[model samples]
Target chain A: MQPNKITGIGLLTAAGVGCEENYCNFTARNSGICKVTRFELPTAKVKTDFAGLIKSLPNEALPPELLQMLNSDDLAQDYVKAAVYVTAEAIKDAGAAEKISSDPRRTGLIVASSLGNFLNVSELVKDYFMKELYKITSLIHGMNSYLPSRLGSMFGVAGPCYFVSSSCTSALNAILQADTLIKSGIVDRMLVCAVDVCLETGTFHLWNKIRVLSHRNESPQTACRPYCKTRDGIVVSEAAGCFVIERADAVGARGHATIRGIGMANGASDFLKPSPELLEAAIREALALAQTPSDKIDFIAGSASGSPHCDHMESEAICRIFGARAREIPLFPYKSFLGSTFGTQALSEGAFAIKTMNDNLVPEPLNIFERDERVAANAYYKAADYSSYHINNTLFVNYGFAGNHMAVVLEKC
Target chain B: MSKPKITREELIEKIVAAIKKVSGISIAPEKYGDNLFALGLDSIKAIQVVNMLEDELDLMIDDAHLPKFTSINAIAAHFDSLNK
Candidate 1:
């Protein structure tokens, strides 16, 4: 059950830049949702009004050399910038920057983004189709594959590098792959980074057309009511989380997180429609991998981000796994504070879980005015239940589009 | 193909404009001597600058030659050798 340890973590969310800022924001419990100001929303067309869109990390937050390279890549997509920022932060946080800087063979890179350079796709389409002689290369820069390869090239990590796209579960999948590589002795260290700059005109409208995004336009902050009776649907966001992971036996890391168990599955569930059976199966597999039972899980974390079906299915799955004991475990759907960041949700949630588990602070549920009737019966969490609580063994479950389900177990070492 | 960008000044204009277009940064005509990276130039923007220059001027700027062309002055120098 022992796996590679997560030495360093760098998170960039609407909560703010850096791990501490994100944790403070999560613990302080403030909503990062706002009406589209970074890019105007299609008020005339889509009902979805607001999203947590962050265009760039603060200049100070980005590594100086990486920032310069980004500014130089006039065509550098947001995904690339995010990947670079978090990768640098993680290496620095892990104190592995100097160690790995000398030996490219010791390290590898993995970057995941659900919708890679989606916003830039609009510009690319215009360049290719509209213009008589378009800049063809513009389209090439936005593709997903460039993300990790670029980071590897930048950091001189020659071990293994590529992209993983599994919709919302991408971050988990990235970490899962990193864990596999390390355990297999293929690489001693890995930079696992995931980003989704969700505010692209091309991609957002697609979600809007599908009507999965929230239309609580007037009240953007209270819009995404996950697991609440008044829940509507997901309020999209832009964010990224990066980690420096190494074999537990390899490095004396700063904050260590061993991958006790990880499981993922997919079935005949339709695209956009989550499969609860598959989710539960994934959780069971993860628990089995960790060699731990359900009763040992101190708390659970997931984003019941007002996707009624997903919330309902997740509730059923949790009840099935924990039974009446579910009432004793606190289900923290912290995305109620930050809008649902598509691919990086679980990673950001994992960051929160690490902070919560270490600090033993169970942050209050944000804006859960009234728990859903089904959630009330099966799970234990309410607005009134907000206060500091204990955390140890934690379970994180995430589902991507197209029935892609993932569950991971993290234990305090 | 696109009139073979005739002069270094002309090439610099295109490169500077490319920089502005790609990164949303505006460069002062006088700041050509300044390092573009120091002024917020990144790898993506560098590729864009190369792409724009290559396409418009019908000039082939090697990726290896990119680091040498760190500023407007440095890029103009590259264009100078290519032109000659």
Candidate 2:
């Protein structure tokens, strides 16, 4: 069913601190991945060197009390605080905050993350080494350590404060949930946040074991090479993204960003394997929701993580769904610079694509030297001046671990 | 007399390496008896350690007994005692 359109979206990512900066970087085709400096890693298979780390915060830039909560020692707490702050920004951007504040009961929050405050938990766990494990309070908060409750408490959002953790699909699923709530008239407005922080050990070793991490120790800047034949694997990164979604009428009354449509589906394949059928289904669902034909979708923002298996499945899916038009539709893969921050990557990239649509141009994919022939035969990939194109319609696609696929359609409003 | 089979010191070195590989923590051999949970090793990492040990020493420790075998010393001793 069609829900209310998203009226406003605010984002903080590695490309920049907010929507404006992220757009600027995207338009310029700037890469955010760089040598890791947050922590030390000596024995990593790939250098613990590259990531799309968010270096700034909105509260700090805007100077607000909300920023203080985010700056707390607890990283998970900081993520919630950041989510609330960004939601407020989106509301203000939508011009619906005063109305939302008036009827707090009508508002809700859905935050998603794969690795919440893992760094904070690691520190606390380290602290327990010095103290007694049993002595640690039951309320000890760390990375995903009860982020949903914390977000609810901070924002005074009373309805449906929940966290969705579907690995990389977490954020997109959160958005899907928010859309459902708004369409069902369960809430007038919903704030969706996706946040994650770097954990030193478990996270690091997991990737090392899989050997899907980039080992370009010398050139961290170019480490993430999505869609490139030489692409080794994805670099892990961290950031928090949030947006405020409300009914089109509500947003029209306040003049916020408009949401055209959102679609989600799961692959029936093995949890770790990608499935073309599911990917096509997700794209079709999004197109159906947008009520726009495939030809109208000017560009496709891909969830290409540079894995051979994932790229193959996604390429096949695009070819199947769009047919000849797929070749004409410009394809963009932004994850090479952003690194896959679990599920939040999709939310942030989707937001970027929406902004690009607003600008009437499609953002270029970074570090892609060659396009898959299947996709190339069905899609276009190259650096072109966005100004020359009319990106009235765009599709944002993301895939998550365990075969979760999501697609969202955006149109110039 | 037969050499004291796999002395505590020898076991500590093996445990430390395995833990480092699985949990990504670098701890001294002297710290083997320390509670791993308190040291930030989660359930996932604990499982990794058990798997590593099983592969290294050919032991088939049951998953049900993981919690009781929290420390490196505990895991090593549990394996050692089983063979004894």
Candidate 3:
């Protein structure tokens, strides 16, 4: 069966609060990663303090009632509120708020998370163990645990409301699920949201154990170098992204952005290791579903997260998929600007690609002085020049910890 | 000269407010016993209502009891029994 198309997309990230701001930042090739100012962390491990943190959620941003409910010490509920806020904005952008609001049964919601309320969990556990206080209320637990449902309730959407947790591939998985639900005639419209917040003390230790985190305290901006030979490690960031998707017929009637195609695959490799085969399959499948030939793909939003092995594997996958043509395709590493926030990266970059297609430009990969020579030799890879070209089609790739790989293709409407 | 105890009618009102507060649902008291799942109350929303009950009424309901608290009347009765 044919899939449902995404008619509208909205995003809130460390770059800026809304699509317009993010688009401008992208066009200007600006990076939102800077010093981590919201929370306190150890001075040593925070060497590269850069993170794409959303800094401007005004108190009056959400409905008064919703804001009150969120401020009630319910961190999980705050995530729901964050998802709802962005989802509502996307729906509004799609011009479907009235239609869905009047008949919510016709709408569905899918939220994805790599670590659901991990920050809140860490704090609660710490308080329990350290202070010997069981003051963590059930409300907090329920909100943290039921973010998807809370978001559904807020929007009055009675359709499928569940969380997709696949480490980093959660966003793409959520989008794929929304597409399937719409195709099955289960719902006419769906809201896809991806969110993850930064870790607290325990999370810091967990990353320290993984040894993928940068410990360079001097310069944070220079810390996360995705394709650079001098790259050390990746920095974990926090963000949330949402999109409003509808059937092609529905979107056509309303004249909204069109979702050309989406594809997903599993690595079937070890949870921590990379898989070239799965990545290639995912890209090939996404291109096939999009009905886009590899040559037509103008740019690629690389998921090169500065992990040396992952970067090499991803580069190899691209070479395998596009063959000789891969070297000519310009590449944009979004995570360089927005620190890798597992599930949010794919959707966030997807949103960025849509904006790039809309603006007729592609943002350059920042901080990479030299291209991956092998990739550059085989693929049409370059720091993109937005002024000289108009990007019609683009591919966005995302890889998760459990060998889950997803690639999505979007075209200009 | 007050009434000996609270009536079912009074209990239903409180239950309705709590449900609305927790699950963001608006329903008439008479429709409380209706299948919440059929009414679009999924598992996550069920947990939200249970948490609200614990907060508002100081009652602890097991996660297992969620399937049984499908309606306003049912949750109210359960809370009433617990208060006893």
Candidate 4:
């Protein structure tokens, strides 16, 4: 099968909006996590009032008529509007907005969302329990398919539309699906968008019950320390990322990064803890498909979201794949810089991979006071502005809830 | 004990406050005569206004009556009829 190329990428994160802004923040080691001021954390039971919230959503980028197509209160949802803004940004970056509109049948849209417009869902549940359901104008507004369908309508993309929901690995899985469609010749191009909004009070309370969220209310920015001895848990965050993937020869210009291979594995045993064997299986599958040796990988964009068990599981998997050389290879857990954006993370980290390839430097993991002893992989903790690093390829991993593991290999074009 | 009754002017004032709270834009004394929908009060914002007024006045305004709330005076008249 012919390879697929990531021609353009658009990112909306707490770190910054757009590719340039996010890359600048990454190089400077700036964490976008901060104390929550968007909504009230009413219950004292919920631990931390901290999150990575996009300071200013690009709502102004969304025209009123575009939102009117939803015909409901979905226009009030940040996640919905964010998907459109980032998609437009990606298509514009690809320089194919007009081309996409002209060939609508050949362009597919796939959206990955973990919570699926939970703020609206929360409001609907509240009204239902309060016996105020009569106030709801549209009942289907909070469905998972709402985003991709509405986006397809707004962007004039009508081919092979789908919504993938796999928690943290959602976006990476979406990328894998996009690669499949392109390789199978189902479509000439595909737009993959992932978004999650976890800042709402109801959502915060629900995640707090999971007991895997960080409680570093005093030090919000340094809360998420993946693979470190002091690592606690993920810092919930909200973000959206969009990517335009097309056939390698189809693009007029050279693309950002070429998709060498993608791999997926499920442990099928546990819901919370992942098996190292499965994780290794995913990474090895990707390496095998790419026909690239493990040593060819310059660095790893790890899926360590600060949870001790999850980080250790990934570390074990890395050791199994690279053996003792895992300690020598740099592992950059990019989530340390942007918190755990959940669904949007894999795509955001994919953007980071492209940036590293273009800028020729890997960034240091933030807030790693001391690395865990048992975790064998070298958690990169130095200035990585190496022009001579020969950074050509990267292995990006995403470990999701319910034993879902996905790995993707990206090569410099 | 039940709350005391409110005059039509006071009702209009409360409705304006609810509109401002929901829509984030203040309805001027002159624009009170203009259609709320024309002023960008969609169904969501309208429901929010009704909810805020329900909390402030301790009454339930069924959404069946939502369309009757076109202008500030119209909302005031509707509320007065409901109380009557």
Candidate 5:
């Protein structure tokens, strides 16, 4: 099978918007997290009222149908608009937007969103019980596949259109699906976009009730202390990261970054908390599929989302695989820079890694500080100026609830 | 191609206004027979039209009857028949 490559990318995160802008903000180490001011919550006792809230939605930059949804009062409507905007941007970046999705029969659309417009669904349920009102559109909009289906209609992608909700690993799993399709000769092109805006009152209210969210809401700036021993909890962010992946031969000389190998495995023993052994196996699986050695990998994208439970286990996993060399290979953890964008953070990390590798610069990460001793030894030394390294392959690993794990190896083309 | 009947003229007017309010499209009365789908009305926008009609006419439309709201003339005739 021909190798698959990321020809185009479109991103809307707390980091920034669009391909160039998102990459620029990443390299500049700009923090996208801020105080939540869009809507007020009366459920008052929460520690921090701040988050990586995206206030600037480019409605004018989107297509008409998507723009209509974005302007609506329902928070869930933004899902459709965000997906379209990023997907369009990715297609444009690949230099395919002018004649994008032209072959409906050859392209597939898949989005990974867990809540699937939870705010609107909550509002609809409330409307039904309180006011005895039932709307047909509400019934359809409540489905998880509804948002991606809108994208399927908008882009005329006649191939399979679906949604994947595997907790934090959702987006990476979606990418794995696209890779499978391309390698198995199912489709030539795939448009994969992951969008989640659950920061809506209903969802975040529940998260606050559970107290898993960072209590650092007061200071959105340092709320997310990623990969550090002082880390407390994760900060939830709203974003949509998109990419148009195509067979490398199709793009030929125009290739952006090659997707070398992808690996996904379930927990062997533990049901919830992470297993360092399982994570190590996942990384080894990816390297095996990519036909690359551990020593050959230049850097590793650590999946430290301010969750110490994840950090310790993942650190052990790295040590198990790389041994003494684990301390030498630079590790770039994600959450410190953009909070935790749930499953879609996988795509954002992929985008950031691609840009940094292309520019041959490892820009300092925001909110990323002194790492716990285990990761400190292997940490990518944060520098003010771009430092040169023999970077070729980068590994991206993301863990989900229920011990689901995914590791993707991205190689510079 | 035939002209709309004089009796259904008022219902047609309200239906046109309702479509405009729901979908933001201002169509001339001559396009009364045109397909709503052809006029850029999606399932969501079409459902929005149903909602506005229910509020304006003070009648609850059956879920099964929603498909009849295809064009200005169709909606007017459907409401007229329901009024019988």
Candidate 6:
């Protein structure tokens, strides 16, 4: 079977809403990192409270029909609201809403999340002791699959609907699943949405406890300085990236990008530390599957989220895979502008890759004042305008917790 | 200690509310005696109703009694027997 194509995309991030808004902000080099205003974290407990939080999208961010469907109650739940908004936008963008609604059984949905409704789980725990105040709302919120299942119901998708959670690589893995489903003829079209809302009190506290988050509260703008010598750690953020993926030959299809290759591997090493060996293997596997030479990869959407150890590991993997060409490829550190969005960041990067390819412009990585000599020092990090270069294929790499490495090759369709 | 007594009308009202709360399907007054399946309550929705009722009333409904929970009236009778 021919490779599947991403026909439509919906994006909601701290930077902006929808595809056009986000691409414009990204090309303008605007950073979405900002002060945490959603929840008041006690200053004494952590070094910084800065995060990329979309408390709620403005009414103008959504179409009038979508706006009417969403009420204040729905908007209050961050993940639920984000999932619905992005899915609707994606379906509308693909013009698949009516098609799917008419033939519900042909469409499926897969949602990915690293942490699903931490606030609801916290409430459920509390309500466990006080049964009188208990509500079944937690059931809807706490289940990661609930996001896709609800979207399936709302959008009239009667086919396979589920969730994938593999630490931070959840989104890419979910996308991979969509690719498989299409190739195997299980579903003609799949709606994939990856969302993570870590701004909630409980989830934020746990992330801080892990000490992998940046503590540069003083400079929130530069908090996520990926691959910089002075970089502290990742700045946790929230985002949702939804896509309408279908077979390339489908009727009325306008593919934004074709997924050429998808490679996934488990390092089976440390639970927290990433393994460079396995990551390099995953990249090579993707390149082989794509049937493209390493030199043909025009650019790489790097997943360096500023963690000292992980950045070094990712750099090592890049150097190993690309060898001498590693220093020449234009590698854009997406997390620098978007922050570490966990499971959703990869899908968000995929969106950026498609947009940049369409525009034929490579934006510079943000906040990398001093490149770390220890991590991919020779790697290229320069802006490329249309006159200087042309992008045909982009590589998106993501290394998740518990040693999960995922890579995908997206070619311009 | 004795279980607090609940009237049949009150039980039916709570059941109706629980059904609406879990499934978002309002139960008409005349449908109180109708089978929950006929009223559009699936197994999952029925269990959710049971869970909500259990929490609200602080009652430990038996597993065997689940089949009897087909209608609002049947659930009220089971709860009444437990209370007695």
Superposed on all Cα atoms, the candidates' RMSDs to the truth, in angstroms, are 18.9, 10.1, 18.9, 17.0, 20.0, 17.6
Model 1 local distance difference test score: 0.75
Give per-residue CA lDDT, model 3, range B1-84, as digits (tens): 432455677777876776677568888756777877676665445656666656566554543355478777788788777766
> Across residues A1-413, which tens digit of lDDT does each residue of candidate 1 receive?
24778889888887777787777766566547776766655666555767887656555556667666664443245666676777777788898877687778878888887877676677777767788546645666676776777778788788888888888888899889999998888888888888888576656666665546666788887887878877667788888888888887766444556678899888642566778889999999999998879999887887477877778888889888988878778887767777778888767777877777777767666666776777742344553453555566889888857678988988875
| Overall lDDT per candidate, in order of appearance | 0.75, 0.69, 0.71, 0.81, 0.74, 0.80
Looking at model 5, the pairs that clash are A48-A217
Tens digits of per-residue lDDT for model 2, A305-357: 87776777787788788887766777777676677777687567767777666
Model 4 over residues A255-291: C-alpha lDDT tens digits? 8888999888886454666668888999999999998
TM-scores for all candidates: the values are 0.79, 0.77, 0.76, 0.79, 0.78, 0.79
DockQ for all models: 0.01, 0.03, 0.01, 0.01, 0.01, 0.01
Sliding window of 10 residues with minimal summed lDDT for model 1 chain A: A377-386
Interface RMSD of every predicted model, in angstroms: 18.2, 10.5, 15.8, 17.7, 18.8, 18.9
Q: Please state the CAPRI-style docking class of candidate 3.
A: incorrect
Shares of reference contacts reproduced by the candidates, in order, are 0.00, 0.00, 0.00, 0.00, 0.00, 0.00
The docking category that best describes candidate 2 is incorrect
Candidate 1, superposed: residue stretches over 4 Å from native: A58-61, A74-76, A252-254, A376-389, B1-84
Note the chain A TM-score of all models in turn. 0.93, 0.89, 0.90, 0.94, 0.92, 0.94
Number of the top DockQ candidate = 2
Candidate 3 docks with a DockQ of: 0.01
Name the runs in model 5 displaced over 4 angstroms. Answer: A56-58, A64-76, A97-102, A268-272, A368-371, A384-386, B1-84
lDDT of 4 at A156: 93
| Error in Å for residue B73 of model 4 | 68
lDDT order of candidates, best first?
4, 6, 1, 5, 3, 2
How does candidate 6 fare on TM-score?
0.79
